[model samples]
Target: MSTDTPPPLPRQPAAEAARATEPASPGIAGVDDTGVPAGGGDAAEVGRGFFRALFDLSFRTFITRRLAAVFYVVGLMAIGIAFVVYLVTGIVEGVGALWFNPGAGISLIVATVILVPLFAFLAVIALRFVIEAVVALIAIAENTERTAANTRR
Candidate 1:
Protein backbone atom coordinates (compact mmCIF):
# COMPACT_ATOMS: atom_id res chain seq x y z
CA MET A 1 0.00 0.00 0.00
CA SER A 2 1.23 3.55 -0.79
CA THR A 3 2.04 5.65 2.25
CA ASP A 4 -0.40 8.51 2.63
CA THR A 5 -1.49 10.92 5.34
CA PRO A 6 -4.99 12.34 5.83
CA PRO A 7 -5.52 16.12 5.79
CA PRO A 8 -5.40 17.75 9.23
CA LEU A 9 -8.78 18.32 10.84
CA PRO A 10 -10.10 21.85 10.58
CA ARG A 11 -9.16 24.07 13.48
CA GLN A 12 -11.87 25.23 15.81
CA PRO A 13 -12.34 28.97 16.31
CA ALA A 14 -10.49 30.31 19.34
CA ALA A 15 -13.65 30.90 21.35
CA GLU A 16 -14.99 27.46 20.50
CA ALA A 17 -11.64 25.85 21.23
CA ALA A 18 -11.50 27.52 24.62
CA ARG A 19 -15.04 26.48 25.37
CA ALA A 20 -14.31 22.91 24.39
CA THR A 21 -11.15 22.71 26.46
CA GLU A 22 -12.63 24.18 29.64
CA PRO A 23 -15.84 23.61 31.53
CA ALA A 24 -18.53 26.04 30.40
CA SER A 25 -18.17 28.90 32.85
CA PRO A 26 -21.62 30.46 32.88
CA GLY A 27 -19.99 33.26 34.85
CA ILE A 28 -20.79 34.73 38.26
CA ALA A 29 -24.46 35.18 38.98
CA GLY A 30 -25.93 38.23 37.17
CA VAL A 31 -22.65 38.82 35.34
CA ASP A 32 -22.25 39.30 31.59
CA ASP A 33 -19.84 37.61 29.18
CA THR A 34 -17.15 40.15 30.17
CA GLY A 35 -17.80 39.27 33.82
CA VAL A 36 -19.29 42.66 34.66
CA PRO A 37 -22.69 42.76 36.34
CA ALA A 38 -25.19 41.92 33.60
CA GLY A 39 -27.25 45.09 33.53
CA GLY A 40 -24.48 46.77 31.51
CA GLY A 41 -23.57 49.78 33.66
CA ASP A 42 -26.95 51.43 33.25
CA ALA A 43 -27.21 53.87 36.13
CA ALA A 44 -30.55 52.57 37.35
CA GLU A 45 -29.54 48.94 37.14
CA VAL A 46 -26.22 49.55 38.86
CA GLY A 47 -27.89 51.56 41.60
CA ARG A 48 -30.48 48.85 42.14
CA GLY A 49 -27.90 46.08 42.22
CA PHE A 50 -25.69 48.08 44.54
CA PHE A 51 -28.43 48.41 47.13
CA ARG A 52 -29.62 44.84 46.67
CA ALA A 53 -26.16 43.46 47.24
CA LEU A 54 -25.76 45.52 50.38
CA PHE A 55 -28.87 44.01 52.00
CA ASP A 56 -28.32 40.54 50.70
CA LEU A 57 -28.26 38.60 53.93
CA SER A 58 -27.20 35.48 52.09
CA PHE A 59 -24.05 37.30 50.92
CA ARG A 60 -24.46 35.86 47.44
CA THR A 61 -23.37 39.03 45.62
CA PHE A 62 -20.84 41.79 46.09
CA ILE A 63 -21.09 45.59 45.80
CA THR A 64 -17.52 46.71 46.16
CA ARG A 65 -16.66 46.28 42.49
CA ARG A 66 -19.51 48.54 41.50
CA LEU A 67 -18.60 51.17 44.09
CA ALA A 68 -14.89 51.05 43.40
CA ALA A 69 -15.02 54.06 41.15
CA VAL A 70 -16.78 56.10 43.76
CA PHE A 71 -14.27 55.00 46.35
CA TYR A 72 -11.41 56.00 44.09
CA VAL A 73 -12.86 59.44 43.55
CA VAL A 74 -13.37 59.94 47.23
CA GLY A 75 -9.87 58.75 47.97
CA LEU A 76 -8.46 61.16 45.42
CA MET A 77 -10.44 64.01 46.88
CA ALA A 78 -9.19 63.24 50.37
CA ILE A 79 -5.60 63.12 49.20
CA GLY A 80 -6.01 66.36 47.33
CA ILE A 81 -7.43 68.08 50.34
CA ALA A 82 -4.56 66.81 52.44
CA PHE A 83 -2.10 67.98 49.87
CA VAL A 84 -3.54 71.44 49.78
CA VAL A 85 -3.45 71.74 53.54
CA TYR A 86 0.16 70.54 53.74
CA LEU A 87 1.30 72.82 50.95
CA VAL A 88 -0.31 75.84 52.55
CA THR A 89 1.22 75.02 55.92
CA GLY A 90 4.67 74.50 54.44
CA ILE A 91 4.54 77.79 52.58
CA VAL A 92 3.38 79.63 55.68
CA GLU A 93 6.13 78.11 57.80
CA GLY A 94 8.70 78.80 55.14
CA VAL A 95 7.60 82.41 54.87
CA GLY A 96 7.73 82.85 58.62
CA ALA A 97 11.24 81.38 58.72
CA LEU A 98 12.46 84.12 56.33
CA TRP A 99 12.56 86.59 59.27
CA PHE A 100 15.20 84.71 61.31
CA ASN A 101 17.65 83.10 58.84
CA PRO A 102 17.44 83.99 55.15
CA GLY A 103 19.52 81.07 53.86
CA ALA A 104 17.80 78.39 55.92
CA GLY A 105 14.40 79.89 55.13
CA ILE A 106 15.16 79.80 51.39
CA SER A 107 16.31 76.22 51.73
CA LEU A 108 13.16 75.31 53.65
CA ILE A 109 11.00 76.91 51.04
CA VAL A 110 12.78 75.12 48.22
CA ALA A 111 12.62 71.77 49.96
CA THR A 112 8.97 72.17 50.79
CA VAL A 113 8.08 73.17 47.24
CA ILE A 114 9.89 70.19 45.82
CA LEU A 115 9.22 67.49 48.40
CA VAL A 116 5.60 68.21 49.29
CA PRO A 117 4.42 67.78 45.71
CA LEU A 118 6.52 64.66 45.35
CA PHE A 119 4.97 63.20 48.46
CA ALA A 120 1.50 64.15 47.27
CA PHE A 121 2.18 62.42 43.99
CA LEU A 122 3.35 59.39 45.87
CA ALA A 123 0.19 59.44 47.98
CA VAL A 124 -1.96 59.51 44.89
CA ILE A 125 0.01 56.63 43.44
CA ALA A 126 -0.42 54.68 46.66
CA LEU A 127 -4.14 55.28 46.65
CA ARG A 128 -4.35 54.04 43.09
CA PHE A 129 -2.44 50.88 43.97
CA VAL A 130 -4.73 50.19 46.91
CA ILE A 131 -7.83 50.63 44.79
CA GLU A 132 -6.39 48.41 42.09
CA ALA A 133 -5.60 45.75 44.67
CA VAL A 134 -9.17 45.75 45.90
CA VAL A 135 -10.53 45.41 42.38
CA ALA A 136 -8.09 42.60 41.65
CA LEU A 137 -9.27 40.72 44.74
CA ILE A 138 -12.87 41.17 43.67
CA ALA A 139 -12.02 39.79 40.26
CA ILE A 140 -10.38 36.78 41.86
CA ALA A 141 -13.51 36.18 43.93
CA GLU A 142 -15.69 36.45 40.84
CA ASN A 143 -13.50 33.97 38.96
CA THR A 144 -13.58 31.58 41.90
CA GLU A 145 -17.35 31.81 42.02
CA ARG A 146 -17.60 31.18 38.32
CA THR A 147 -15.42 28.11 38.65
CA ALA A 148 -17.60 26.88 41.49
CA ALA A 149 -20.73 27.41 39.44
CA ASN A 150 -19.22 25.44 36.61
CA THR A 151 -18.39 22.52 38.86
CA ARG A 152 -21.76 22.43 40.63
CA ARG A 153 -23.46 21.08 37.54
Candidate 2:
Protein backbone atom coordinates (compact mmCIF):
# COMPACT_ATOMS: atom_id res chain seq x y z
CA MET A 1 0.00 0.00 0.00
CA SER A 2 1.12 3.59 -0.67
CA THR A 3 2.44 5.52 2.40
CA ASP A 4 0.72 8.79 1.34
CA THR A 5 -3.08 8.98 1.72
CA PRO A 6 -5.05 9.30 -1.52
CA PRO A 7 -6.06 12.84 -2.29
CA PRO A 8 -9.60 13.65 -1.13
CA LEU A 9 -12.27 13.39 -3.85
CA PRO A 10 -12.54 16.63 -5.80
CA ARG A 11 -14.93 18.98 -3.95
CA GLN A 12 -18.03 20.14 -5.66
CA PRO A 13 -18.39 23.92 -6.10
CA ALA A 14 -20.27 25.46 -3.13
CA ALA A 15 -22.83 27.18 -5.34
CA GLU A 16 -23.58 23.99 -7.30
CA ALA A 17 -23.83 21.88 -4.17
CA ALA A 18 -26.12 24.37 -2.47
CA ARG A 19 -28.34 24.57 -5.52
CA ALA A 20 -28.60 20.81 -5.78
CA THR A 21 -29.24 20.06 -2.10
CA GLU A 22 -31.12 23.00 -0.53
CA PRO A 23 -34.88 23.40 -0.84
CA ALA A 24 -36.17 26.75 -2.10
CA SER A 25 -37.19 29.37 0.49
CA PRO A 26 -40.63 29.04 2.10
CA GLY A 27 -42.45 31.40 -0.26
CA ILE A 28 -40.27 30.43 -3.22
CA ALA A 29 -41.21 26.81 -2.88
CA GLY A 30 -44.81 25.69 -2.25
CA VAL A 31 -44.19 25.47 1.49
CA ASP A 32 -46.80 27.12 3.71
CA ASP A 33 -46.58 28.20 7.35
CA THR A 34 -46.60 24.52 8.35
CA GLY A 35 -43.36 23.84 6.40
CA VAL A 36 -44.98 21.00 4.46
CA PRO A 37 -44.26 21.38 0.76
CA ALA A 38 -47.26 22.21 -1.34
CA GLY A 39 -47.66 19.42 -3.88
CA GLY A 40 -45.98 20.35 -7.16
CA GLY A 41 -47.71 23.74 -7.38
CA ASP A 42 -46.36 26.59 -9.48
CA ALA A 43 -44.01 28.79 -7.48
CA ALA A 44 -45.73 31.97 -8.59
CA GLU A 45 -49.05 30.65 -7.41
CA VAL A 46 -47.55 29.76 -4.08
CA GLY A 47 -46.04 33.24 -3.67
CA ARG A 48 -49.30 34.95 -4.51
CA GLY A 49 -51.17 32.76 -2.09
CA PHE A 50 -48.70 33.54 0.68
CA PHE A 51 -49.03 37.29 0.18
CA ARG A 52 -52.82 37.12 -0.02
CA ALA A 53 -52.93 35.40 3.33
CA LEU A 54 -50.62 38.05 4.80
CA PHE A 55 -52.79 40.89 3.50
CA ASP A 56 -55.92 39.38 4.94
CA LEU A 57 -54.37 39.25 8.40
CA SER A 58 -53.13 42.86 8.24
CA PHE A 59 -54.98 45.85 9.84
CA ARG A 60 -55.98 47.20 6.45
CA THR A 61 -59.30 45.44 6.83
CA PHE A 62 -60.11 46.62 10.35
CA ILE A 63 -59.22 50.28 9.76
CA THR A 64 -61.13 50.33 6.52
CA ARG A 65 -64.28 48.91 8.08
CA ARG A 66 -64.30 51.27 11.07
CA LEU A 67 -62.98 54.42 9.37
CA ALA A 68 -66.34 55.84 8.33
CA ALA A 69 -67.83 55.59 11.79
CA VAL A 70 -64.78 57.15 13.41
CA PHE A 71 -64.68 60.06 11.00
CA TYR A 72 -68.41 60.70 11.39
CA VAL A 73 -68.08 60.94 15.16
CA VAL A 74 -65.14 63.30 14.88
CA GLY A 75 -66.94 65.49 12.37
CA LEU A 76 -70.02 65.69 14.57
CA MET A 77 -67.96 66.79 17.54
CA ALA A 78 -66.19 69.49 15.52
CA ILE A 79 -69.42 70.86 14.10
CA GLY A 80 -71.04 70.86 17.51
CA ILE A 81 -68.12 72.83 18.93
CA ALA A 82 -68.40 75.34 16.08
CA PHE A 83 -72.11 75.80 16.69
CA VAL A 84 -71.57 76.30 20.41
CA VAL A 85 -68.87 78.88 19.80
CA TYR A 86 -71.08 80.74 17.34
CA LEU A 87 -73.96 80.81 19.79
CA VAL A 88 -71.79 82.03 22.68
CA THR A 89 -70.23 84.73 20.56
CA GLY A 90 -73.65 85.89 19.36
CA ILE A 91 -74.83 86.23 22.96
CA VAL A 92 -71.67 88.16 23.89
CA GLU A 93 -72.14 90.46 20.88
CA GLY A 94 -75.73 91.11 21.79
CA VAL A 95 -74.74 92.13 25.32
CA GLY A 96 -71.83 94.23 24.00
CA ALA A 97 -74.20 95.96 21.53
CA LEU A 98 -76.38 97.07 24.44
CA TRP A 99 -73.25 98.74 25.84
CA PHE A 100 -72.40 100.22 22.37
CA ASN A 101 -69.05 98.32 22.05
CA PRO A 102 -68.17 98.67 18.30
CA GLY A 103 -65.14 96.36 18.63
CA ALA A 104 -67.26 93.39 19.68
CA GLY A 105 -69.58 93.76 16.64
CA ILE A 106 -66.65 93.96 14.20
CA SER A 107 -64.96 90.93 15.77
CA LEU A 108 -68.18 88.92 15.64
CA ILE A 109 -68.72 89.64 11.92
CA VAL A 110 -65.08 88.71 11.15
CA ALA A 111 -65.36 85.44 13.03
CA THR A 112 -68.66 84.51 11.33
CA VAL A 113 -67.33 85.11 7.83
CA ILE A 114 -64.00 83.35 8.33
CA LEU A 115 -64.80 80.46 10.64
CA VAL A 116 -68.02 79.14 9.07
CA PRO A 117 -66.40 78.33 5.74
CA LEU A 118 -63.46 76.71 7.53
CA PHE A 119 -65.83 74.38 9.39
CA ALA A 120 -67.71 73.59 6.19
CA PHE A 121 -64.47 72.63 4.52
CA LEU A 122 -63.73 70.31 7.40
CA ALA A 123 -67.17 68.71 6.99
CA VAL A 124 -66.42 68.03 3.33
CA ILE A 125 -63.16 66.36 4.32
CA ALA A 126 -65.06 64.15 6.74
CA LEU A 127 -67.40 63.15 3.93
CA ARG A 128 -64.45 62.21 1.76
CA PHE A 129 -63.08 60.11 4.59
CA VAL A 130 -66.40 58.29 4.77
CA ILE A 131 -66.25 57.47 1.09
CA GLU A 132 -62.67 56.24 1.25
CA ALA A 133 -63.48 54.17 4.31
CA VAL A 134 -66.35 52.49 2.52
CA VAL A 135 -64.09 51.60 -0.39
CA ALA A 136 -61.51 50.17 1.94
CA LEU A 137 -64.15 48.11 3.71
CA ILE A 138 -65.28 46.61 0.42
CA ALA A 139 -61.72 45.78 -0.54
CA ILE A 140 -61.14 44.09 2.79
CA ALA A 141 -64.30 42.04 2.42
CA GLU A 142 -63.33 40.90 -1.06
CA ASN A 143 -59.84 40.02 0.07
CA THR A 144 -61.19 38.02 2.98
CA GLU A 145 -63.39 36.02 0.67
CA ARG A 146 -60.54 35.32 -1.72
CA THR A 147 -58.26 34.26 1.11
CA ALA A 148 -60.89 31.93 2.48
CA ALA A 149 -61.34 30.29 -0.88
CA ASN A 150 -57.62 29.85 -1.30
CA THR A 151 -57.26 28.28 2.13
CA ARG A 152 -59.89 25.68 1.39
CA ARG A 153 -57.75 24.12 -1.33
Candidate 3:
Protein backbone atom coordinates (compact mmCIF):
# COMPACT_ATOMS: atom_id res chain seq x y z
CA MET A 1 0.00 0.00 0.00
CA SER A 2 1.12 3.55 -0.68
CA THR A 3 2.17 5.38 2.49
CA ASP A 4 1.36 8.88 1.18
CA THR A 5 -2.18 10.16 1.47
CA PRO A 6 -4.04 11.38 -1.63
CA PRO A 7 -3.65 15.05 -2.39
CA PRO A 8 -6.31 17.32 -0.89
CA LEU A 9 -9.00 18.37 -3.34
CA PRO A 10 -8.76 21.86 -4.75
CA ARG A 11 -10.82 24.26 -2.66
CA GLN A 12 -12.95 27.10 -3.96
CA PRO A 13 -12.13 30.58 -2.67
CA ALA A 14 -14.50 31.78 0.10
CA ALA A 15 -15.75 34.76 -1.89
CA GLU A 16 -16.42 32.65 -4.98
CA ALA A 17 -18.24 30.03 -2.90
CA ALA A 18 -20.35 32.73 -1.22
CA ARG A 19 -21.27 34.27 -4.55
CA ALA A 20 -22.26 30.86 -5.88
CA THR A 21 -24.42 30.10 -2.85
CA GLU A 22 -26.15 33.48 -2.40
CA PRO A 23 -28.24 35.41 -4.86
CA ALA A 24 -26.72 38.54 -6.33
CA SER A 25 -28.81 40.74 -4.07
CA PRO A 26 -27.98 40.51 -0.37
CA GLY A 27 -31.28 42.14 0.79
CA ILE A 28 -34.87 42.21 -0.28
CA ALA A 29 -35.37 43.73 -3.72
CA GLY A 30 -38.99 44.75 -3.14
CA VAL A 31 -42.11 44.33 -1.03
CA ASP A 32 -42.59 40.87 -2.53
CA ASP A 33 -39.66 39.46 -0.54
CA THR A 34 -40.99 41.02 2.70
CA GLY A 35 -37.50 41.38 4.14
CA VAL A 36 -36.31 44.64 5.56
CA PRO A 37 -32.77 45.74 4.71
CA ALA A 38 -30.08 45.04 7.26
CA GLY A 39 -30.26 47.44 10.27
CA GLY A 40 -33.51 48.84 8.92
CA GLY A 41 -35.67 50.31 11.69
CA ASP A 42 -38.51 51.75 9.63
CA ALA A 43 -41.86 51.27 11.33
CA ALA A 44 -43.69 51.26 8.01
CA GLU A 45 -41.59 48.37 6.74
CA VAL A 46 -42.14 46.49 10.00
CA GLY A 47 -45.90 46.96 9.69
CA ARG A 48 -45.85 45.69 6.13
CA GLY A 49 -43.92 42.62 7.22
CA PHE A 50 -46.42 41.95 9.99
CA PHE A 51 -49.33 42.11 7.58
CA ARG A 52 -47.47 39.99 5.08
CA ALA A 53 -46.85 37.31 7.69
CA LEU A 54 -50.53 37.31 8.60
CA PHE A 55 -51.45 36.97 4.95
CA ASP A 56 -49.09 34.05 4.34
CA LEU A 57 -50.82 30.80 3.36
CA SER A 58 -49.72 28.84 6.44
CA PHE A 59 -50.56 31.64 8.85
CA ARG A 60 -53.96 32.20 7.27
CA THR A 61 -54.80 28.53 7.54
CA PHE A 62 -53.72 28.47 11.19
CA ILE A 63 -55.90 31.43 12.00
CA THR A 64 -58.83 29.99 10.08
CA ARG A 65 -58.71 26.64 11.86
CA ARG A 66 -58.30 28.27 15.28
CA LEU A 67 -61.23 30.60 14.67
CA ALA A 68 -63.33 27.74 13.34
CA ALA A 69 -62.68 25.66 16.46
CA VAL A 70 -63.54 28.61 18.69
CA PHE A 71 -66.76 29.27 16.80
CA TYR A 72 -67.64 25.58 16.84
CA VAL A 73 -67.34 25.39 20.62
CA VAL A 74 -69.21 28.67 21.13
CA GLY A 75 -71.98 27.54 18.80
CA LEU A 76 -72.39 24.23 20.58
CA MET A 77 -72.56 25.98 23.94
CA ALA A 78 -75.07 28.52 22.67
CA ILE A 79 -77.24 25.74 21.23
CA GLY A 80 -77.15 23.86 24.54
CA ILE A 81 -78.15 27.02 26.42
CA ALA A 82 -80.94 27.71 23.95
CA PHE A 83 -82.23 24.17 24.32
CA VAL A 84 -82.28 24.55 28.09
CA VAL A 85 -84.12 27.86 27.80
CA TYR A 86 -86.65 26.32 25.43
CA LEU A 87 -87.18 23.41 27.82
CA VAL A 88 -87.82 25.82 30.67
CA THR A 89 -90.16 27.92 28.54
CA GLY A 90 -92.11 24.86 27.40
CA ILE A 91 -92.52 23.70 30.99
CA VAL A 92 -93.64 27.14 32.23
CA GLU A 93 -96.01 27.74 29.30
CA GLY A 94 -97.48 24.21 29.76
CA VAL A 95 -96.62 21.43 27.32
CA GLY A 96 -100.24 21.48 26.03
CA ALA A 97 -99.58 24.89 24.42
CA LEU A 98 -96.99 23.24 22.14
CA TRP A 99 -99.65 20.99 20.61
CA PHE A 100 -102.88 22.87 21.47
CA ASN A 101 -103.32 26.64 21.75
CA PRO A 102 -106.44 28.80 21.54
CA GLY A 103 -104.57 31.17 19.18
CA ALA A 104 -102.20 30.10 16.42
CA GLY A 105 -99.49 32.39 17.90
CA ILE A 106 -98.64 30.19 20.91
CA SER A 107 -98.55 27.12 18.74
CA LEU A 108 -96.16 28.85 16.28
CA ILE A 109 -93.94 29.97 19.14
CA VAL A 110 -93.77 26.41 20.50
CA ALA A 111 -92.94 24.99 17.09
CA THR A 112 -90.22 27.54 16.60
CA VAL A 113 -88.75 26.75 19.99
CA ILE A 114 -88.59 23.05 19.13
CA LEU A 115 -87.21 23.59 15.61
CA VAL A 116 -84.52 26.09 16.65
CA PRO A 117 -82.54 23.33 18.42
CA LEU A 118 -82.64 21.12 15.36
CA PHE A 119 -81.47 23.96 13.12
CA ALA A 120 -78.65 24.84 15.47
CA PHE A 121 -77.62 21.19 15.67
CA LEU A 122 -77.52 20.97 11.89
CA ALA A 123 -75.49 24.18 11.67
CA VAL A 124 -72.92 22.81 14.10
CA ILE A 125 -72.63 19.64 12.08
CA ALA A 126 -72.19 21.66 8.90
CA LEU A 127 -69.45 23.77 10.44
CA ARG A 128 -67.62 20.62 11.56
CA PHE A 129 -67.86 19.22 8.07
CA VAL A 130 -66.51 22.42 6.55
CA ILE A 131 -63.51 22.45 8.87
CA GLU A 132 -62.73 18.81 8.19
CA ALA A 133 -63.10 19.34 4.46
CA VAL A 134 -60.57 22.16 4.52
CA VAL A 135 -58.07 19.96 6.37
CA ALA A 136 -58.56 17.09 3.93
CA LEU A 137 -58.04 19.38 0.96
CA ILE A 138 -54.82 20.74 2.42
CA ALA A 139 -53.59 17.21 3.12
CA ILE A 140 -54.34 16.23 -0.46
CA ALA A 141 -52.42 19.19 -1.77
CA GLU A 142 -49.39 18.29 0.39
CA ASN A 143 -49.57 14.70 -0.78
CA THR A 144 -49.67 15.81 -4.38
CA GLU A 145 -46.69 18.08 -3.89
CA ARG A 146 -44.73 15.27 -2.23
CA THR A 147 -45.56 12.87 -5.02
CA ALA A 148 -44.53 15.40 -7.62
CA ALA A 149 -41.20 15.98 -5.92
CA ASN A 150 -40.54 12.26 -5.67
CA THR A 151 -41.35 11.77 -9.30
CA ARG A 152 -39.06 14.60 -10.33
CA ARG A 153 -36.24 13.06 -8.31
Best by lDDT: 1
Compared with the true structure, what per-residue lDDT tens digits does model 2 show for residues 25-67? Answer: 6343554543234546688886675566557866443333324
lDDT of 1: 0.82
Once fitted onto the true fold, the runs of candidate 3 whose alpha carbons sit more than 4 angstroms away are 1-53, 57-68, 74-101
Per-candidate TM equals 0.73, 0.36, 0.42
TM-score of 2: 0.36
How far in Å is the alpha carbon of 42 misplaced in model 2?
A: 42
Residue-wise lDDT of candidate 3 within 95-152, one digit each (tens)?
5564566455476566667776787678678767876786566556645765798899
TM-score of 1: 0.73
Better lDDT candidate (1, 2): 1
Instruction: Pull out the clashing pairs in model 1.
Output: none
* RMSD to true structure for each model, in Å: 5.2, 14.7, 13.4
Stretches of model 1 off by over 4 angstroms after superposition: 1-34, 40-46
